[model samples]
Target: MGQDTKYIVGVDLGGTNIVSLLMNKRGEVLERDARLTLAKEGRERTISQITGSVSAVLEKGRELGISPDSLLGVGIGSPGPLNTKKGVIHFAPNLPGWREVPLVEILTQKLSMPVFLENDANAAALGEWWKGAGRNTSNLVLFTLGTGIGGGIIIDGEVFHGAWDTAAEVGHIIIHEEGLLCNCGTRGCLEAYASATGVVRRTVKAIKEGRETILTDWVQNRLEDITCELVYKAAQKGDKLCSWIVEETARYLGVGIASIVNILNPEVVILAGGMIKAKDLLFKPVREYAKRYALKDAIEGVSIVPAELGDDAGAIGAAATVLKRKGLL
Candidate 1:
């Protein structure tokens, strides 16, 4: 493909969904599609599903009179502990039984084009850095506040994978050395308190311990249905317990962010993911706490903001990865 032809394809693969985007080299989306992952059929089937989705997008592009041969390439963002260098997924806790899958090779062979793989969180960060909130900033950190906290860091316009390809794992950063237990077998990691699951877990624990709260009445037998949105609504309705739950969660997130500030000193920090939908109910407290805890100079000129790309961040970042790989950016 000619350098100035300006066409790329990006894919975001999640435990429950697969989304694809056709974009110009400038990162603007021309077309997009999303479908359920249906991961129950196992790794190979899941891979096929991804391939099918990508094929569908290309077919759509053809219908739009966009030649598939003119496409730059494909980029994919997926759950991590992956080897970006080799485009191999070592083990994705989110995707059941997927071990050491050579995803890049699979997609490349199927598409007859170059394919790149990166952790989803990292891809989102790159997306933000390239065309969203992190625009004009080279040093940036992004935290995805979803089922579990996921993180990505960009230093000098490149994603930092660290020595173990898990360098920017801000979620695992221990905010409380003896606090909550994490799925990774660690205690007090930031994810255990700030993520959607974390907020619900804390609320449930508080209620179980006889803390007076309205959540007790609002929640039925099924605690799993109690989402971060429910908590935010309860807080907005002046439920003291719910308010406390959100505040405490924000405090933990802020402290965790402060630590990132101290360590990486990124120019911008962006929050993305489902929980960010709470709007100011969450961002205000997190900003306040960050101000209180982060170093004066570090927090002084640093920008902390919500991600602007929303659901498109991962796919956009995946597309940017193709640009980066091709030395276009």
Candidate 2:
């Protein structure tokens, strides 16, 4: 097969889902598959799901007249405190029983091809840099604001893996002193204030304190059922408490982004994940606060925008990792 006809597979492994894609050299996805991760079923079952998703995509590629021999390899974006150099998952909080698993080695053995691994957030950053909002920019920072916040930094078209391969941990940045507790056992972390979990947590506290808001009625007075999305929806209808929560969330994000902007001076700051659904309500204040707190010169010409690739960012970024390693992208 000619080099031009060769393809690559990208896999995004999450606790809830495993998404796989087959892509040609031109960065077009030719085939894709997704399946439940069933991570609670243990490591072996999760690995099976990963491999099965890969096989499904490859089979679809075959139907498209693509040969298995024309495939380059596979790259995975997995949740981590992992070692990319060793392709070992030191541990993943979301994927229980995945301590020091030699995932690349296992996948390479099972699939009979080269395999690579990267932190999912870093892969998403690369994906955005290559084809999404960060395209045409060499330095970019991405914040994935979901249940918890995840971050990825791209410097000079490369994922910035710091000394311990744990760089771009933007969520843990201290935004306040002795403030709200974070899941990571730290107080005042940005994730404690800016993530979806944070928004819901704060709103729940407010409601419990007898702060009046339509969110309680929206969630049928079941405070435990309240979600960040509900908070945003209520805010859209001019619910005072929910609007305050949204604004607070945006302010927290702004403070975090300001710190990032001051330090990295990235060309673009991209916000991804479920919280982006809040759209202007979240973004307008975030931009304002970021600009307010950031260095005047540094803030100039920087664009803070929503991520474009959405769910596909991780998978596409995983493929970019392989192409980058192979010097094809």
Candidate 3:
């Protein structure tokens, strides 16, 4: 390893998977490693998995003849409510036993490098802003629409972390006054209607209500087999039943995002996550509804696009934060 060689590590800590990356100054991903988070095993185990992944990426970099001895830092993208400045996860609903873990301090001690932390969604937004779909835009809003919706806001070039670090929670915005209950224990949240979980829930409810659908038969009457993807497939097959469900989901998302556009008027709205694979099926309704709901002047030329980085957004964004912090971006 050369003394002047510079590198940095990025970790995306998810409930199911932990991904690490070794990135160079030119923003090329030199090496990557991913492993199960095993979060249920407890905090120490999860952190160990993350650090091990980071080390594995670094080792892979070495195998590729990249002797980057001067590691700039390690950056972590974690599910929040987290104190980004203090580097503690106050509480992350996805990970059990992760209450107030001093992640930055612990990882720095373990890896012998400075560590920085950011909320995973915010990191993804930063990632998209730095190198993905939002590169051409200044004010951007991102929505990760999966099991639940995660939002990130970038105003100008910086993340909009509110006074309490809870800004840009676009998912929790109330769209329905008395709509479905959300996992957050709130009624009528955008997440309740827009998320993949919400799509499945709505499908199952329709099936139970005796609404005829191809999905019920496709899953062989096994309600659990119907997922958001299956719903999209069914819709693609021109199955009217599932098509309406997916359209309604997009409607929910569009209306939710409409609130964001009306309030902040971001230059671009990036929709990410597995659900985005639905492509036109998802974007069409979202755009239509958003245009209808948001102020015309607010959204005239705002681009609503899919995230380009996909799963890499979080990790890259985490690392990007380090560069951004050093003013190296």
Each model's backbone clash number: 0, 0, 0
Candidate with maximal TM-score: 2
Count clashing pairs, candidate 3: 0
Worst 10 residues of 1 by lDDT: 214-223
- Write candidate 3's Cα lDDT for 137-186 as tens digits: 78999999988898999998898999988888888999887878888787
Candidate 1, 182-229: lDDT as tens digits = 978989899888888998888888877877766656776466677788
TM-score of model 1 relative to the true fold? 0.96
Query: Against the unseen true structure, what C-alpha lDDT does each candidate score?
Result: 0.88, 0.93, 0.89
Candidate 1 runs further than 4 Å off: 220-224
Candidate 2 structure lDDT: 0.93
The candidate maximizing lDDT is: 2
For each of the candidates, the C-alpha root-mean-square deviation to the true structure, in angstroms, is 1.5, 0.9, 1.9
Worst 10 residues of 3 by lDDT: 1-10
Ranking by TM-score: 2, 1, 3
* Residue 259 in model 3: lDDT: 85
How many angstroms is residue 102 displaced in model 1 relative to the true structure, after the best TM-score fit? 0.8
Decoy 2 TM-score against native:
0.98
Assess every candidate by TM-score. 0.96, 0.98, 0.95
